[model samples]
Target: MVENLTEEILEMLGNESRRRILNLLSKKPCYVSEISYSLKMAPKVVLDHLDKLEKLGIVSSYEEGRRRYYSINRNLRVEISITPHRFIASTVSETPELEIDEFIKNMENLLKTPAGSLREIYKALQEFEEVERQFSEILGAVSLKFNEMFERFLTEIEKEVEDELERLVLLGITKGADTPFKISEEYGISYMGVIKALKSLENRNIVEKLENEDVWRIKC
Candidate 1:
């Protein structure tokens, strides 16, 4: 498993386009057209990279109408370690014991089998109900864990930025100021000072300026 994970990570990093896609997604969730425009790549090419990233669980997407917005999978962390003997790459995240996709495929195949008696069908239904209950419990646990991890992550980020001005600037952006000008006016800071703080935030990947727009947005 370690070998397989290492190979997967290597393959992901080997492509320049994939790396660029990750960089952009890290800053903000974006639709395919947005990513393609920002990277100056073809839409088809951007989608190909997104597909590979999604398969590896490094990226995830959600649909809004006809557009799908892609973002990094914050639940999983990838780590690489090198020792004298070998290099290892691994993912640290919660994984279900029963693979849902495999379960669904098996159920579909089972449907082709000969019909069983009513008693057998009843027993199967009971078993399926038990499995469903267990899955629900597992999903609840995963959701709680993810929320805890996210809160802890936010706490760490808060501690990392100790500057009062920067924090205020971040708060302003979080409050929905799209540009530094609004933040500056609200905080009574000079425009240049706001820009400086914004630049720092951008460097830390805490905020991103949308392409073709003068507005900035908080990444979190």
Candidate 2:
């Protein structure tokens, strides 16, 4: 039985920079300077990108004198996942409890059968003991994608808020004891701007009101 290799490989490959490097290497082998020139990036930047791809075993390199040449390792097999930046290894094995070997072999053989048997094929898959493992893997993949998406979204939101706050301070609205609405009014800002800033502060848990409870303040 083949063990699942896709999940681990895909997780590592999901980095945009790394994926770009991999795609470049797949076409043909190139040295670092050649890659940097092709990608229109600095050699150090290319090295960082290659470091990640190499760690995932997607790319390999060998020294040619003082320089190294890298190439895509074609032997690596990946099972692409439906979700973005995710994949499962083609050689996934079922849990020990499942009678998987023969069942998988049968499915592979029957895959070419007529479309009329699709329902029966799905039913058979459901009945297979290894189906549990497949579902678990799917869930794991979903969770990973969600985490990555959430992280990127959070970073973008943080950057936007920081820029907004700088703008607000320039307009003299970073004063103490002013409610967000009051600050917005004083700075001639729209209510939406105030709301967004307040929300950002709340997310960072940095918003604090004075002892009077009516005065809005943010911790430095």
Taking all chains together, each candidate's TM-score versus the true structure is 0.38, 0.35
Q: Per-residue alpha-carbon lDDT of model 1 for 101-130, expressed as tens digits?
A: 688668746543336888767777777777
lDDT score of residue 188 within candidate 1: 82
Question: Top model by TM-score, which number?
Answer: 1
Each prediction's total of clashing residue pairs, residues at least 3 apart in sequence or on different chains, is 1, 2
Which portions of model 1 miss their true places by more than 4 Å?
A: 83-85, 94-220
Count of backbone collisions in candidate 1:
1
Cα displacement (Å) at residue 172, model 2: 58
**Model 2's TM-score against the true structure:** 0.35
Off by over 4 Å in 2: 1-5, 80-220
